[model samples]
Target chain A: MSTLRTEEMTLNMGPQHPSTHGVLRFIVRADGEVMREAIPDVGYLHRSIEKIAEKVGYHGFMPYTDRVDYVCAMFTNQGWGMASEKLANIQVPKRGEYCRAIATEFNRLASHLLSVGTMGMDIGAMTPFTHAIREREMINDLIEELCGARLTFNYMRIGGVAWDLPPGWREKALAYLDHFEPILDEYNALISYNKIYIERLANVGIISADEAVNYNLVGPNLRGSGIKWDIRKDLPYSVYSEFDFDVPVGKGEWGKLGDAMDRYMVRIRELKESVKILRQALKQIPAGPVLAKVPRNFKPPAGECQIRVESARGDMGWYAVSDGTGYPWRVHVRTGSFAAMGIIQKLSQGLMIADLVTLIASLDVIAPEIDR
Target chain B: MEAARIYQRIKDRFGEHVLEISDHQPDPFIVIDPASIEEVGSFMRSDPELALDCLSNESGVDYKDRIEVVYHLFSYSKRHGAVLKVKLPRENPTVATLENIWKSANWMEREIFDLLGVIFEGHSDLRRILMPEDWPGFPLRKDFVEPTEYHGISTVRESPIIRLDPKKK
Candidate 1:
């Protein structure tokens, strides 16, 4: 049979589409099933968050950071807190640091559950998402008890957390982890190794380690590319160094290294690590006042610093500049999802239309983070 | 591979291009000439001793008189990082693009351009990434004023609590 010449087509995905994750829009130039390029047109969710930081003083800005990435708000909260603390040279009490870590790890667990559960739902597996959310709901209850808010828990303050773990909350969190760990194994058997899911994700959207580094991919995305770097383990921010937990990297067991499945597996394995860290943190949390003696009208000296937190998405960088005043001169957040979105145009070339969803889900690009 | 050593290496390699270095600050930053940014960036990334492979964070801050572009460089192999800043004229803040040296600089440069109005010369696709194409001014700039409306939609809303108060009326 003679070959047929097909015309190129331009298609728009999202700005409203569910699979685009949040308010992201992509302009895809495709020749049949293979995409020539998927140019991402972001900013639909731009709330001028960094600008808001300037308007709100250092202490008041804690709640605004929660909206930066609501899925993983703790890291944003912690990143802002750490940056301000570093700028002001304030030492968080040891007990306050442990509380921050405890609340943060639980937030990590909740964020990853939503990510993987949605990964399954985006790829046509509905049952796994419900199962994942069911587990996530328990985590929400635990976090809600700790901070009072479920989605946007503004838990961390500049020097420390808003409050200590509530009475009997430590035991409740430990019990939840004990119940949550087995569900992870059952989740793996249900969706992770399924033949169809593997075929959809394993070999698609492969990002080599060099490209991953060049693009500055952080957290699980960087580890999924087999770089073996995690800001928490390597840099030891907050109370992370005192805890005993292992960092997981993608092994490329099923397909090519740095493929979609590699990223997915990295998140799944990190969930276990979060559990391990939570177990250690709950048992070793020191007793003292969680809130430090920060003045009501706080002002740091004139200086600027960038602090990196290994958030659920990856490494979230908070670049805060203070001009020896009540208001911050400038604040910029360098987010993982922002960098991940940058590489999509290059990765989308020659990828199948359906596989585009797989690539995005695997990367776990949250829209608010990108637009912020 | 401490940050000061990394700064000293760059200072030695490009003496005239290095403008100033402040060690007193909590996080020391070396200011580089806007013209020689690409060269300094290339040297930092390729130099074996200062193998700063990743452009981890890039942001722009408007200081009213001048605009500053900050690049947070990290070395995964050497396990060290350095902060580089470029000061440009406030009127037309233009600097050489480091996108070619570091692929991650591509979107970050675009973001700086969009929010702070810094021009990255030779950037392949220098378009707004966060704001609308027709957005009036750089929202992050210190002198910027939020427009009253955009495309006929009001940007601000009256406080409902104030509106509902009978005593105020």
Candidate 2:
């Protein structure tokens, strides 16, 4: 059978498009509407933070970690803090562990709410986005009470946390948790189960478990593909072993095991687990020093270390090489969003233009994390 | 499969090809010759017991005399990790690509090539992932200096000179 030859149309999705997240551009080769290939163009936000690690001493680099991934800055803060601690062999106190865990869980809650709500908005629903933002504001307030800033919290310290909980902050955080647990249900009713939402997300942007693992997908994306991998539960860190929590993986509730809906559902289920972890941390936290007393000229022995953190995105790895000096010899941050970038061109091969947006939203690839 | 065991297994399998195995400060690692990286990666990916299916992170470090490439590999099934390192001469830092073994290494290798200037021998598309393709010199190297300007845009920031504001002074 003879067929007509057609040229693929070139479409640019922006270093400025609202949907591509931040500064991420995709040049898609499309045959009419279906994308033949969508090669991603990243690095718009690269500030050379790793190079800065050489100039700035260990402590001076804390705030920069927040910029590495601001959506869930607390985790990156903790990641860097812990990496430094590992390098120096500093032991964080019991109270410090509880504070780090509690703050981290709250940050996780805020990050997931934004991810879910924004995905909803990206899929044509707007109300859920507002609802998600409303709940997130409460978290912002709670975090601000603990640390001064709201969005970029350089809260975690090298040995401990930057600040101790303010007077009555615990009571307020517990109240917010009580209020927040019920909001997850409201989120489900308002947008999670909507017919249009399900149809738009379900069975789209499928990533097989093997592909997920092979791609080095971290956090929920790998778990969403039914691979039971989580640094928090698997390779326990920061008193996480003491707490009881469930690791949620995609069971293909609406479609195949690793579809857009599966990844979305994984984040939704994570909200419940985060709340559970928060409640336990709040109850178990004991009174002690918040900041560990590290020396002024802190120099870790010459060595190389790789610290993995379960941030909002998949595995966030901080690799640091110290040469028995105050400054790190070399610092490299390998983020989940960076790994996820490899899959976009593969996933976008046969998807419609609209489906591509859904895939981007479902993957939850943030710009700064990938470009850092 | 602890890191020590994994190192031992790799040492046993590859004998003289293994350069040095050490349990340094925090983690255990095995330094291997750069030429056998692809083959080692293949066995690591296909082996059931030591199924290192995930290439967590690949980093290139620059010392004065030599360049070091570090590969952090993890096995989901076995719940184990191994750090594979290769030391290359500073003149021509080239290591065989493991992109075929772990698809994730595709962009990661490119990034190292872009920022650190380590050449990945068989990377499918080894181009700049972070910096512009034509960007001058690898910025991560210790000896690299910041350019004064780029495309007429000033790259240096004015030093914060002690100045008295007319109103404050």
- The candidate maximizing lDDT is 1
lDDT of each: 0.92, 0.91
**Model 2 lDDT per residue over A30-136, tens place:** 99889999999999999999998898999999999999999999999999998999999999988998999999999999999999989988878888999999999
DockQ of 1: 0.88
lDDT per residue, candidate 1, B83-166, as tens digits? 999999989899989999999999999999999888889999999988889999888888898998999999999877744667
Pairs in clash, predicted candidate 2 = A218-A314, A219-A314
DockQ of 2: 0.89
Off-target runs (Cα >4 Å) in candidate 2 are A1-5, B160-162, B165-169
> What lDDT would candidate 1 get against the real structure?
0.92
On a 0 to 1 TM-score scale, where does candidate 2 land against the true structure?
0.98
Instruction: For candidate 2, write residues B104-160 as lDDT tens digits.
Output: 999999998998899998788988988877789999887898889888989988888
Chain A TM per candidate, in order of listing? 0.98, 0.98
**Residue A91 lDDT in candidate 1:** 93
Using all chains and alpha carbons, the TM-scores for the candidates as numbered come to: 0.98, 0.98
Native-to-model Cα distance after best TM-score fit, residue A3 in candidate 2, in Å: 12
